[model samples]
Target chain A: MKNFFVIIVLCLFISLQAFAGLHVVTTTTELAAIATEMGGVHAEVKSLIKGSQDPHYIEPKPSYASILNKADLFIAMGLSLEIGWVPSLLTQSRNAKIQRGHEGFIEPYQGIRILEIPSGVVDRSGGDIHPEGNPHYLMDPRNGVIVAKNIAQKMAELDPAHGDSYQKNYEIFAETMNHKIGEWQRVLSKHRGLKVVTHHQTFSYFADWLGVRVLDRIENKPGIPPSPGHMVDLIKLIKKESVPLVLLENYYDPKPSQKLAGETGVKVLTLPVSVNGVETVTTYAGLFDYIVTQIVGAQ
Target chain B: MFTARLMVVLFCLCLLFSPTLVLAKKKIPDQSSEGQVLLWKFNQTGNKALIPDISLIGIVSGAYFRDDPATVQWPNPTRTGFNLQAAELGIQSVVDPYIRADVFIHMLEDGLEVEEAFITTLTLPLNLQIRAGKFRARLGRENTQHLDQKHFADYSRLRRYFLGNEGLTDLGAELSVLLPVSWFSELSFDFMQGRNDVSFDSPRKQDFLYVGHWANSFNLTTNLTMQVGVSGAFGNNVTVRKLTQIYAGDLYLRWRPHERRGFKWETEYYYRSLEGAVATAKEGGVTTSMVYQFARRFEAGARFDAIGFPEDAFSQYQVSPILTFVATEFFRLRGQYNFLHTDGAGKKQHEAFLQLMFNMGPHGAHSF
Candidate 1:
C-alpha cells in the first residue's frame, strides 16, 4: 500500500509536466500543419489522425484521451466530419478545457460556407451525409487561409504572451497562400468546364472552387460500397460526358476505381488528399501543388 | 429433427442473402450541380437549447433449452421460448465544468428500476477521477457491463452462477487514477453498499465493501491490441459464513484494422471463497468468448464456460455458438445455440436463442 501511494504520487507529478507554450490537438494532419504554421515557436501541435487515412472512420483508442488530456486547445473540422471518434475522445479526456463550450475548443469551419447540406430529411439513406455540411472544405486552398487565421487567434487568446508572434506568423502564411492561390487558379483556369468524376464526394469544395464539373461518384452513398448497377450508371455517365480524370484518394481501396477505369477507358488520377498523404506532399502548400499537377498531367 | 433443423438453416440463409440482392439496387443519392448547403451557424453564445444527451436501448430475447439432469442454474433463462428480455433508458449530460451525470433506468416486468445513476468528476487533480453512484461491481471484466451491452444474447453458466440473474450491481462510489507508467494503465478502487442475497441482505448497511481493479492495454501492432487486468472484491455473504471474497483476472485481444472488419477474443477467470456463512469453501470458474467479424455487418462468435460450485464436487461446462447481424448502427439481431453438459451425475441440455437489440438517441462510443 505504501509503494502504491508512492507510484500514484509520482505518476501525477509526471502528468503535470508544464509546457512553455500552448499545446494544440487537431483532428487531422492538415489542420495540425496549419496550426504549426501559425503557432510557430509559441505552440505545440499534434494531430489525432494521420494524412493517409480516411477522416470519416476512426477507431476509438485510449491513447487519444491520454494525449487530449494534455491539450490546452483543440481544433477540428466540425460539420459532423469527425462524428465517429472526436466526440467520444472529448468526453473521456477529463480535461475540461478542451470540452465543448470551452474557449479552448475551436471548429475551423465556423464561418466558411459548407457544401452538400441536404435539402430534406437526411439520414444514412442519402449515403453518410454530414448533418451540418460537407466537411472536406480544406480541399480549397482559400479556406486554408481562414483555417490558419482561426488557429492564430485561438493560440493568441490562450497564450497572450505570444499573441503578436502568432499574428505575424499568420500574416506570412496568408500572404504565401494568397500568391499560391492565384498561381493555382491560373493552372486550373483552362479546365473550368471539363467534367470530372471521383470515387467519393470529397472533391466538392475543390470542384466548386475551380468551377470544374463533377459528373458522378462511384460510390452510391457516402459509406456504402458501390453496387453493380451504380457502377454501370457511373461508367455510362463518365463515358457520355467524356470525363478526362477519375480521382481517388489514398485512404480507400483502388480496385473499384481501377475497375471503373478499365471499363470506361477514362484515365484515373489518385491524388494525395491530405498533408503527408504522399512523401512529396509534406506540407499544406505541397498538397495543392501535387493535386493540381496530377490533374493537369492526367489531362 | 435433422431435416427440420436443416430447413431452418436454409431459410435463414435465404433471409440473409436476400438483403444483398436488395443492396445491389440501393437508394443512390442524386447529384447536385450546386453542392453548397449552409444552415444556421452554430454560435458559442449559449443561445441554443441545452438538450440532455438521451438514449434508449431495448433488448428482446427468446430462448429454448432442454432441462439438465441435476437442475438448471440460477438466472440462466431456461425457458425454451420467446420472452421480452429487457430495456434501458439512459440520460447523460455534463452537469457543469466540474462533473458529468449518467443515469440508466431498466424497465422490467415488475416496473422500472434504477440500473445505474452516477456522477463522474471531470476536473479532478492528479489524473484522478471520482465516480459516485450505483454501478456494477468491478469484480470481473464482464460483470461491470450491463445486460444490453453484452456481445452475446444469453448469459453464460459461470456468470449465471456467480453474478445472479441481474448480475452483481450495487450502490457504489469509485475513484480511478490514470497511472503514470508509460502505457495505458488505470487503477480504480470502489466502495459500495452491498446488495441483498448475493452478498449482504441489507440495503441500509453502512459497512461498505471494497473492490479494486487494475487494467493495462497496449497495441501489439498497428491493428492488434492486448489488454490484461486483475480484480478483487470482498464482502459479506448470506450463505453460511460472515465473509465472501472474489479474485479475478481477465484478458482481451483484438485486431481492428482501419476500414475493415476485425476480431476480438476475451477470457476471464474467477475464484470465489465463502467463509463461515453457508458454505465455508471455495468455488472457481472460467469463461472464454471469441468473435470474428467476417463481413461488413455480420459477425460470428462462440463462448465456452466451465464452473464448479463450492457446495458440490461436480462441475458444469457449456459451449455456445452465436451469429449476429448489425442491421444498422443502432439495431442488431443474433441467433445462438448452446450445449450444456455436467460432470458427475448431470445430464446434457441443448438450447437455442434469438435476440433483437435496438437503440435510439445519443450514446457515445465506449472506451476501448
Candidate 2:
C-alpha cells in the first residue's frame, strides 16, 4: 500500500511537469504579442504569421501544420479575415482538439463591439469586402484594452493555476494602453474631425477612434483597384471635400494613390498598420507610435 | 412497404414530439433550441440551333438533385448521350455559431451511365479548405462544372484528348488557401487517387498504372478579378513504363466595361511531356475564348483551340460558338457548336444541351 502511494505521488509529480503550461498558437503577430504578455512564462505562444506579413495571406508552411497538430489552443481574428487558410489547415493538420467549435478555437471577438456590419447582400464584385465590416478593429487603442482583457480572462480560465499571474499581466497591458490612449488623444486632438481619404478601408476603426472625418475611399470599393474613371471622380471628390491627407497602408500598390494625391495636392500618409509592419515598427507600442508620428508629421 | 413502415414510424415520433419542439421553440424564441434548417431551389433552360446543319431545343432539369427530375432521352438531345443533366439536394445550417457543415448530393443520368453523385466541403477559413469523398478534380475552369453551369459546352480538343470528354472525379482530398497580401489571389492544391473519367477500371501495363498516378497542382486566380494561373503535375505509370509531366495555365478576364453588360476573355495553354517510347517528346497547346453577355441573361461566346500529338500527323485546331440563356435563378440552359480543322481538313460537330440548375444554398469553394 505504501509503494502504491509512492507510485501515485511520482505520477502526480510527472503530470505536473508535463502540464506545466498550455501550448497556444495564434494566427497573427498582434495576437501573439498580446498572448505573450498575458501568458508570461506559464505558456508558450507561437504566431503563424510574421508581423510584417499581411494577416490575411499566410502561405501555410509545413511548420504551421506541425505546430497546429500539437496546439492546446488556437486564436485568430475571425470575421473571415483568415478565411483563406485557417479551415483547411485545421482539417489537414488533423488537430480535432482545436477545430472550430472546440473549446480551444478562440475567435477573441465574440463579445467585443463589431464595426461596419453590412446590412445587405455582399458579393465578390464588391472587391474583397468583408460583409461583417472592417475586421481591423485592433487598430483603436480602446479595442486593444478590450482585446487584452478578453485574452487575460481566457488565459485565466484555461490555466487557473496561474490565473493571478495572467490577471496581473492584463492589468499591466490595460494600464499601459490606457496611458497611451491619453497621449494619443492629446496627439490626435488637433486632428479631430480632420478630413481624409484612404487607399482602402483599412483605417475605418482608426478613423472612428481618432474622430477623423473620411471624405471618401480611393479604391471606389474595398478590393477593386480604382479605375481611371473612378480615379478622376475621386480626385474631384477629394478636392470638393478639401481632404488634407490620402492615407495608404504600406503594402498597397501606391501608383493610383500617389497619382490621386498629386492630383488633389493632398499629403499621402503611408502608415504602418501593425507593429513590425516594417523593420522599424516591431512592437505594439511601436505600431501606435508610428501611426501617431506619421499622421502628426503629415499634417 | 419498408419505406411506408419507416414513414409511419417517423410520423408517430413527430406526433409524439412535435408539441415538445414547439414548446421549446416558444421558450427559446431565437430558435437556438429548435436549431436552424435552410432550403433552396434552382434550375436553367435554353435552345441550341447551328446554321446549315444541326439544331435542337430541349430542357434539362435538376441543377441540384433535391428530388429526381424525370430523365430525358438521348441522341435526340446530343449524340454524346444524356441531356436533362443534373438534379441536386443540399442542406446546411450552423450546429452553432462556431461550427457549420453542408452536404450536397447530385444525381445525373447520361443515358449511358448514372453520371453524378458527389459531396463538397465549403467551410474552411483563411482560404484553406479540404474536400474529400468524390468530386470533380480542379482541371480546367470549363471542366469543373456541368454544361449549363459552364459559359460554353464543347471543351477544347486537348481537354477531350487528355482529360477526356467528361471531367475527372474520384475518391480524393483537396486543399486550398489564400495568401493574405490583399492581392486578391488564391491557391487550390489537390491530391487524389482516381482513374481518368473516360475509361473506368481498364487494364493497362504496370507503367500505365504507375502513370495513372497522384497529381499536385497549384492554381492561382488573381484578384485582378481575372484568373491567370499556371499549374503542373507529374505522373508515373508503372504498368506502361511511362512518366508524364504536365504544365497548364489559363488567363481569364471578366471585364464589365459596363455593369449589366460585359465581355469575358479567357485563354488556356498547356504543355505535356510523357516519358516513354510511344509518348516521347513534348506536346504544347493553347485555347483562347471570348464571351459577350447581354443584359446579364444572354451569353454568346466562341473559342479556338490547337494542339500537337505524336500519334497524329500534325497539329489540330477547333473553333466553337457557345450560347446560353438564364431562365431563372436556379435554372439555366446552354448550347454549343464545334468546328474541327486538322491541318486544313475540316469537320463540323454540333451539340445541344438543356440543364436544370439548382444553386441551392451557397456552397462555394474558398475564393482566391
Candidate 3:
C-alpha cells in the first residue's frame, strides 16, 4: 500500500511540473508587490484588491475565485481588513494550502506590532466597524518590512529549490528599504510639528512616525458623516489655529474636504494613504515618498 | 428540453466569461473607499468556488399528501415529480469602502408550471435599496429561503402550508435599512409594492398592493441569536381588504461551543386572517425544532409544530426525526421521518425520505 501511494505521488508530481511557476494571490496590491519582490522570478503574484477599489467593500468577483482556485499561495492583511469579503472568497478557492490554518494563508501581522486594540466588545453600532482595532497595519514602514519577511519565508518553504534565491532577494530588498526609510525620515522631520486635519482617523501610524499633531478629524465620529454643526465647529477651530493643510484621502469624495477647506481658508491636500493612490505611486516606497513630498512641499 | 439546455448553457457561459474580466488598472485603496459599482461575485474553484463573504443558494423538495385526491390545494401541492423547488443566485459585494450591494435572482414555482425571476439591490450609503423583478418579502424568516438552507432535512409542517413553500414572492420592489440601536441589537423597517403573491377578490387582473415588515434582533454573550418580526399586506380590491392582515414571526437560536459544529433551537409562529376565504377565519401556528451536530460528519435533530385555525376545533401537529451524514466535503446524505397527526382527521400519517445534497461551492455567510 505504501509503495502504491508513492507511485501515485510520483505521477502527480510529473503532472504538476506542467503547472510549474508558483502562483501567488494577495488581498491588496501592497502585499502583491511584497510577494513579487520576495519571490522574484520564481512566482507570479496577483492582488484581489485593486488600488482604485475599496478594500473593505470588495465584491468577490467570479474572476477572483478562478484565480484563487489555481493559486499555490494566498496572502492577506488579516485582522478583518478584508473580513466581510475574504472568508467567503477563500471558501471558493478549494485549495487546502490557502485555507485558514494552512501555511499558505499568510497573515503578515504575525510578526509585527498591532495598534488600536479595542478594550471593549467592538460591535457594528458605529457603522460597519472592525472590532479588532484597525486592520491598516501596512501604513507603517516597519510593519511593511516585517510582512515582506513573512512572505519571503513562506515562499522559501514552498519552493526550497529557490529558497536561497528568495533569501538573497529579501535581504537586498530590506537593505534598500532601510536606506530609503532614513531619507524619508529626514524629509518628514521638517514638518514634524505641523498640525493637520483629516477626513477619517486613517493616519494614526503616519502621524505617530512624523510626530505631527492631529488637531481634529473632519468626521464627527468614527464612521459617522460630518454634520452641519460639526463642520461649523471644525471651521471655527481651524481659523483659531495656525493650520496650513487639511489632509484628505485620495479615495474620499473631495467635495466635503474642499467645502471645509474653502470655509476655513485651509488648503485641502489630497494624500495617497496606500499604494496605487496615484498612477505614479505604484509601490510602497513610492507611496511614502509621495506623502512626504506633498507635506514638505506645502511648507 | 430546450429550456433545460438553455439554463445549462447560461451557467457554463457565466463560468467561462468570468476569467477575461481582469483587474487591468492597478488597484489603489483610495479610489475604492467610496464606490459606485452595481453587483458582483468572486468565483474560486472546487466546492469553495465563489466569493465567501455573502453569497448563497438553496433548494427544498418534498411530497405533500392531501385528504381528498379530488380537491386540489390551489398552490400547496398540485402535482409533484421532482419539482424545481428553488433556483436562487445572489451577490453581496462591497463596491467601495463604505458601500455594498446585495443582489439576487429568484426563480421558483410562480403558478401552474410557471417559474418567476427577480433581482434586489441593497445599498448601504443612503440606507435605501432599489429592487427590480421578483423577490421574497421580509414578512417572516421562514417565508424567505430560511428552511431550504437548513442543516436538517425537514421543516415545520406549519411553515410548509401557510407560508406556501415559496412564501410571499412576487414581481415587486422593497426598501429597508438597519437602524442604529443600543447594546448588541439591530432594527430594520421595510415597505414594498407591486405584484403580490396572495390572492384577493380583485376585479382588476393586476393591481398594485402594499406590504410592510419590521424586524429586530438581539445577540447575547452566550452565542445566542434571537429575532422577531411582524409583516402585513393590503390590496386595493374591495374583498381583498378582508385578507389584509397577514402576520408572522420566528425565533431562532444556535449555540456553537465550537465552530463548524454545534446545536441549534428554532421556533416560528404564523397567523393569517383571511376574512371570508377558505376557512376564511383566523389561523395561527407555532413550531419548535432542535438540532445537534456533536461530531464531524454526523448530525441528529428533531422538530415539533402545531397549528390552530379558528374554524377547526383542535390543533394539528407534526413531529420529525432527522439524521444526516457528511461523506465528503462536497456532499451530504440526509434521511428524515415525518409523523403527521391531525385531530379532526382520524388519519395518522408518516413519511420516510432520503435527500442527497451536493453543495456547488462555498456556503454564503449569514448576517450577524
Candidate 4:
C-alpha cells in the first residue's frame, strides 16, 4: 500500500510537470473564471472554492494547501471574503510566493468603488460585517472589468515571458465586458426601481448597479440567521413597500424567501450571483447573462 | 457560588450578543457627494502587530440522564445535572518566515491546562511539515478534532471505551508528508510520550508510542466529496499487562449542493487487536452517523454506536439523535438525546442534554 501511494504521487508530479503554464490559484470561482479568460493560454487557474459554495463560509481543507503551495500567483476578493479559509491555506502551504502584498499576490477590489463599509466603529453585531467594503462586488458586471484587468496584469508580472500575450488577452476581456455591461443594462432597464428582498447582503452590489431597491434581507447580517422578530419586521416592510420580488441565490436556504414570498404573494426569483454558481452558468459573462435574464423574464 | 456561576454565564451571553446589539441599526446610506456610500474599510495595517488572530471558545452544557453516578464512564457524564463541557482559548500567529505557533488551553472548573501547544515549521522542502511540541496527534479523525468542533454532544462509544476524557494526545511531535497527488492526500507519522490516561503507555518501559496515519479526500463531483483514511498505533500498556496495538478506519461522505444545505454520512471502526493482561480481551466497535442540513443554520443527525463493554460481559449499543442550531459562526446551540442498551444485562439508559457554544475573537480556519 505504501509503495502504491509513492507511485501515484510520482505519476501525478510527472503529469503536473508536463504543464508549463503559470499556476494561478484564486479564492473564488468568479475570479478563477476571469483569470482563465484573461490569462488565456499563458496561465492555468484553479479556484479554492467552487461558485456554488459561499465564499464567506468556505471550509478549509488540506488539499487546498497543496494546490496553493504550487501556485505562482494568488488572487483574492480581499475585504476578507475568503477570510474563513484562505489565510489558513496560505499559512499551511508555507508558500512564500503568494503571501499578501507580495508580487505574486493580487487583490481586485482596488479599482472598484465599494459600498456598505460601516462609517463608524464596526462590530459583529453588524451581522458578520466585512470590515472592508462589500466583497461581493463581482455581482456587478462593471466590477468584472476591474477583476479581469487585475488578473491579467498579475499574470504578466509573474510570467513576464508572456507579458505581451497577457496584455493582449486582458484588453480583449475588458472590451468584451464593457460591451456586455451595455447589453445587460438594456435588458434590465425595465426592472429599474423594482423593489426586492434579498436573502443575504451579497446582492447589494447587484441591486446598486441595476437601480433595484433592496427592501430588506432575510438574514439581516451576512451570516446571521434571521431572528423571528427580524423576519416579522421584514415582512411588514415588504408589505408596506409592496415589494414585487424576493431575490435568493443558489447558496441560500429557499425556505425563508419562500415564506416571505408566501406572506405577501410576491414572486420569488432564485438567481446564481457568480459563475459556476449554477451548472448552466460557467463563465464570467454567463453569470450576468443568467442573472439578468432571470430577472427580466420573471417580470 | 451560584451567584458567581450565574454572573459568568451572563458574561458569556453578553459576549455572544454584543456584536449585533451594540451596532446602530443604520441603513446602507444613499450615495452622497463622496460618490460611494461609505469609505471606512478595515484598517489593514492596524491589525498586523497587536491583534494576532486570537479567539476564545466557551462551551456550557447541562444534561440529565439515568445512569449510576458511581459507574459514570463518559467525560460529559450521564450525571443528572449541569456541567461545563469545556472552555477553550486558542491563540495562533505566524512567528516568522519559517514557523508559526498555535496554542489552545482548556479552562475547566478544576484548573487550567494547555490542551495543545505547538510550533510548526512551514517552509520545509518536499512538501514536508514538522511540529515539535505536543499537538492533537494526527492519528484518527475523531482524535484530531477539538471538543467544540464535534457534531454530537459526547464522544463515540469506541472513543469512550478506549480513550478517556482527553483524547489521544501526548507530549510528542509529528512529521507529516504531503503526497504530490492530484487529490488531497497526506501521510503522517507521530512519536509521542508513551503516556496516555488510558494506560496504553508502558509506565516501566522507557519507550515511545508510534502512530501512523494516511488520509485523503477526493471530489467526486461538484456537489459531492468523499474522505477516507486508515490509522494504526503501537504502544506498551502498563495496565493491560501486555504490548497493545490498535487499528482503525474512517470514511466520510458529503453531498453539498451549491453550498446551501447538504447531507453528510461518516463512520469509523476500530479494533483493539492485542489484549492487555489485566484488561479485557480483544475488543472492537463501529460508530456510524448520518446528518442532514434541512435548513440553513439547522441540522439533524443520528449516530449509532456499538462498543465492547470491557470489564463486563455485555457489549453496549447506543443510538443518539442530535439537533444543532448555529446562531452564527461564533455561537451554536444543540440538543441531543441518547438511548443506550446493553447486550448481556439488557440494561437501558436514557440521556438528554442542552449544549451552548460561543466563540469570541478571530480564529484560524480548522481542518475540514
Candidate 5:
C-alpha cells in the first residue's frame, strides 16, 4: 500500500512538470512569430492583434486581458505603438509579474536603433505622431535579430532550466536572418536608391535598409486619409521625380494608390508588413520574401 | 507670502525640467544631430516632465424641441437653444509602482463638480485589485462609464429613472478579482455610501449600499466578441425603514474587422424593488442600442429605451437615432434625434441635438 501511494505521488509530480512551460503574450503577430521561434518548445506564445489588423488602434478587448492574465512574459513593440490599448489591458490583467518595469515585461525597442524621433514641440497636427520614435523598426531585418535576442534573453531569465535551449535558438535565428539579409540585399542591388512613393511612414526602416528613397507619401500626414488636393500635388511630384512605384501596406485602403497608379502609370505594390498578414506569408522570413518579390516584380 | 508661493512653484518647475536638461547635455549625437538640437529647443521651451497627464474635454450642443416640455432631465438640454453642456478636466498618473490615480472634474452650469476621484492598486495577490475613494460603481455597462464614452448625446431615460440622473456614482471602495478561466471573467464588489435619493437614502452609518457584479467575455469568432454581466445592489430606504434592492443585466457584442470599421450592439435591463410602509413597489426597464462604423470616420447608431416592464405601473418609451463624424482622435461631431412618449400624460415630444466635443492631451486608454 505504501509503495502504491508513493508511485501515485511521483506520477502527479511528473505530470505537473510536463505542463509547466512559460506562456508568452505579445501585442503584434510579428513579435509572436519571433517569440515562438526563440522560445521554441519551452513556451506557448500568442498575439493580441492579428497580422491583418492595425496595431495603432486596437480596441482593448476583455478576452485579451484573460490571455494576458496568464502570461509569464509580455512583450510589445513599444514606442507607443500600442499606447491606445495595451496599457489598460495590462492593468486589467491583474498579473503583477508582467506589469511595466518588471523582468517578465519586455519592450524590444530598447536595444534597436529607433527612427523618426521627432524634434521640438510635437502635437496632433502631424496626425498621430509617435513621440518616442517609429515603432516599425522590425521592418529592418537587423532589428529583428536584436528583438529575437532580447526575447530569448528574457525567456531564459524567466525559465532558467531552458536557458541553453533559448540561447541556441536565438543563435540559429540570428545566423539565418543575417544570411537572408545578404541574399535580399544582393537581389535588390540593382534597385538601390530607387525612388518610391509610400502610403504611410511605416516603411521608413525598410526603405533605409534597402537604399530606397521615399519621395513623398500619399497621405500628407501620418494616419490621415489622402485628400484630393494632396493627391494632385503628389501626382505632380511623382511625375517630376520619375517615381516608378507606390508601396502600400495591405491593411490600408488601396483606392488612393490605385488612383495614383491610374494617373501616373506607376506600379502599386501592396504588401503585408507583419507575419501571417496574408495566407502565404506565415513566417518572419516569408513576410520579407513576399515584400521583396513584390517590389522586384513591380520593377 | 504670494511671492513665496510663486517661488515654490518655480522651484518645483525647475526640479521637473532639470532631468531633461541633464539628459540632453549628456546625450551623444550619433547619426542625427538634428534630434539633439530639437531636444535642446524643447527644453528651452520649459516643457515640464514630472507633472501628471492633464486633458480638457469640452462639449457644446444645440438643441431644438417640439412641444417643449416644462423641464427636461439633468444634463439634457432643457431650453431649445445652444448650451455649453460640460467641460471636463481629467488628471491621471501612476503614483508609484503599486498604485495609480485618476481625477475628473466637470464644470457644469451650476459649478465645478468632482465626478470621479479614485486610486487603483496595480499589484495584489490572488489576482485581486482594490480601488478606493469616490467612483462610479460597476453596476452595469453604462453606469460605470463617463458621458464622453457613451454613443448617445444624452443619458438613457431608463438610467435616469432608476439610478438617478448621475447614475450609480458615490464615495465607495471596490474589490475586484479576475477569475482563472478559459475566457475573460471578473467578479467585483463595492461598498458605497447610500446617498442617491432616487433609489437609496439612509441616515444610519451602517446602512451602506452593497453591490456585486460578475462580468464575462467570450470571443465568438475571430472578428466577433461578446460580453455579458449581471449585477445586484442592496441598501436601506431609511424613509420607510425598509430595504431596497436593484438587479441588472447587460450584454455587449462587437464585431471589429479592423481599426477602420466595426459594429457594436449593447443592451441593458434593470429591475428595482422598493419596500414601502404600505407595500412593495417593483419597477423595471430595458435599453438596447446598435452602432455601426460603416466608414473610417463616420458611424451611425440607434437606441430604444422602455420603462415600466413586468409590472405596468408606468409607461415611457424613447427612440433615438444618432450619427457621428470623427474628424480625428481629438475631435468629434455628432447629431441625434429623439422621439419620446409617456402614457400618464399621453404626451409625445421630439427633440434634436447637434453636439461638438474635442479633447487635448495624452490619450487615455479605456477598458474593454
Candidate 6:
C-alpha cells in the first residue's frame, strides 16, 4: 500500500509537470496552425482532427477528452462546425476552465462575416446544413487574418505574462498575410468571375474571397452525394456557362469530378483546403499558395 | 410498488410534455427561418428556453429460431416472425451552466417504462462529475449502454446470465473522478437501492448496492487505442443475512486509421458469488467480439459468449455473426445469426434476426 501511494504521488507530480506552458487544443488543423503562429513558444498547440480527415464526421473518441482535460485553451471554428462531436468532448473533459462560456473556450466566428445562413425552414432535407452559417471560413485568407487576431487576443488574455509577445506575433502574421493575400489576388485576377464546379460547398468562402463564380456543386445538397439527375443538370449547366475548372478538395474522392471533367473537357484542380493537407502545404499561408498554383496551372 | 411505478411514469410524462405546452403560448413568426426564429422567440420569452432536444428511436426486428419459444430470452425475438422490439423517447437538455438532464422513456409492447432519468453535474471541481436519480451502473463496458448503442442486436449470454434481463440499472447516485494521469483514467462509485430481484433484493432500507469501477485507456499509437477496466458490485441478497458479490473486467482495442475505416475488438468477463444460508454459489462467464468497418457505411462483426467452466454441470456457449449497414447517421439495418449449445440440456439452437432502427431529432453526440 505504501508503494502504491508513493507511485500515485509520483504520477500526479509528473502529470502536473507536463503542462510547462499554456496548452492549446483546436478542433481542426487550420486553427492549430494559426494558434501556433500566435502562441510563438508561449503556448503548446495540438489539433484534434488532421487536415486529411473531414471535419464533419469526427467521432468523439475518449482520447480526445483526455487531451481536452489538460487544455488551458480550446479553440474551434464555431457556427456548429463541430456540432456533431465537440460538445460531448467538452462535457466529458471535466475541465472547468474550458467549458462553454468560459475564457479558456474560444469560438473565433464573432468577427467573421458569415455566409449561407438559411432564410427558410431548415432541416436535414438540406443534407446536414449548418443553420448558423458556413463553417469553412478559414479557407478565405482574410478570415484567416481575423481568426489569427482573435486567437492572439484570447491567448494573451489567458497568458497575460506573454501578452506583448503574442501581440507582436499577431502583427507580424497580419502583415505577412495581408501581403500574401494581395499577391494571391493579383495572380488570380484574370480568373475573376470565373465559373467553376466543385465537389462540395467547402470552397464557398474561397470563391467568395477571389471573385470567382461557382456555377454549381457536384453534390446536389451540402453533404449528399450527387444523383444521376443532378449530374445531368450539372453537365448542362457547365456546358451552358462554359465552366473552365472543376475544383475538388484533396480529401474527397475524385471519381465524380473526373467524370464531370470527362463530360465537359474542363480542367480539374484537386486542391488542399487545409494546412498540412498535402506534404508541401504545411503552413496556413502555403495552403492558399497551393490552391492558387493549382488553379493557375489548370488554367 | 404499482403506485410508485405509476408516480414515476406520471413525473416523466409531465417532463416530456411541459416543453410543448410552454412553447405553444409563444407564436413563431412566419417569415423568419426555423433556426433564427427559435432563437428569437427564446430571447423574447425571457428565461424560457424550454425546448429541449427531443428524439425518438424505434427498433423492429424479424427473427427465425429453431428452438423452443419458451426458452428464448425476453429481449431477443422469441417468435419466428416480426417483432416490435422497443421504441425509446429521449429528452435531454442543459438545465444550467452546472447541470445537464437526460431522460429516456422506453415503450415496449407490454407496457411503458422510464428506462433512465438522471442529472449530471458539469462544474464539479477536481475533475469530478456526479450523476443523481435512476441510471445504469457503469459496472461493465456494455451494461450501461442502451440497446441501440450496442454493436450487436441482442445482449450477450454472459450479461444476461450474470446481470439479469435489464442489467444493473436502478435508482442510484454515481460519482466519477477523472484521475490525474497522463492517459485517460476514470474512477467511479455508485450507490443504489438494492432492488434488482435476480442479484440483490432486501427489504431493509439500510441494505444498498455499492459498485466501484476503474477504467484506463491508452493511445498506443496515432491509429490505435486500448482501454482496460475492472469493476465490482456488492449488495445484500434476499435471504436473511446473505450477500451477493459480482466482479467484472473489460478490454477494448480499436485501430481507426481514418473516419471511414476501422477495427475494434472488445471482451468482457464477469464473475458472481451469491451467498445463501447454507452455501455459496460461484459462477463466471466471458463475452468477446470483433467488428471491422470494411466500407464507408458497412460493418461486419462476430461475437462469442460462454457462461461456465468446462467442469460445471450447467454450461452454455453461443456464437454470433453479424452484418450491419448504416444508411445514414440516423438509420441502420443489421442482420445477425446466433448458434447456441447447452451442455446440461444437451440441446442445440439456431436463430437468425434482421433488425431495423431509425432515429430523428437534433444530432446527439455519443460516448466513445
Task: Using lDDT, give the best candidate's number.
Answer: 5
Separate DockQ for every predicted complex: 0.18, 0.03, 0.02, 0.30, 0.29, 0.32
Taking the tens digit of each residue's C-alpha lDDT, what string does model 6 give over A131-215?
7778899989999998888788778777889999999999999999999999999999998998998888899999999999988
Rank the models by TM-score, top first.
5, 6, 4, 1, 2, 3
- Which portions of model 1 miss their true places by more than 4 Å? A1-19, A253-255, B1-48, B67-78, B108-110, B146-149, B199-204, B239-241, B276-279, B309-314
Q: List ranges where model 6 is wrong by over 4 Å.
A: A1-12, A16-21, A228-244, A258-267, B1-50, B71-75, B310-313
TM-scores for candidates 1 onward, in order = 0.85, 0.57, 0.48, 0.85, 0.89, 0.88
lDDT of each: 0.77, 0.60, 0.61, 0.77, 0.84, 0.83
By TM-score, who's the top model here? 5
In candidate 2 chain A, where is summed lDDT lowest over 10 consecutive residues? A11-20
lDDT of 4 by residue, B252-363 (tens): 8888774558898989887775555655467777889999988777999999988872333438889999999987888999999999887765558888989999998887
Better of 3 and 6 by lDDT: 6
Among incorrect, acceptable, medium and high, the docking class of model 4 is: acceptable
Candidate 1's interface RMSD, please? Answer: 10.0
Where does candidate 5 stray beyond 4 Å? A1-18, B1-49, B67-74
Model 6 DockQ class? acceptable
DockQ order of candidates, top first: 6, 4, 5, 1, 2, 3
Instruction: Say which prediction, candidate 1 or candidate 6, comes out ahead on lDDT.
Output: 6
- Give the true-contact fraction for every prediction, in order: 0.28, 0.01, 0.02, 0.41, 0.48, 0.47
- iRMS values for every prediction: 10.0, 14.2, 21.4, 8.6, 8.3, 7.3
Scanning candidate 6 chain B in windows of ten residues, the lowest lDDT window is B35-44
Tens digit per residue, CA lDDT, model 2, A115-144: 876657765456566666677888887887
RMSD of each: 12.6, 14.6, 22.5, 10.4, 8.7, 7.2
lDDT of 6: 0.83
Candidate 5 residue A137 C-alpha distance from true site, Å = 0.6
CA shift of A54, model 1, Å: 2.8
Model with the higher TM-score, candidate 4 or 6 = 6
Q: Which number leads on DockQ?
A: 6
Q: After superposition, how far is residue A126 of candidate 2 from its true place, in Å?
A: 5.5
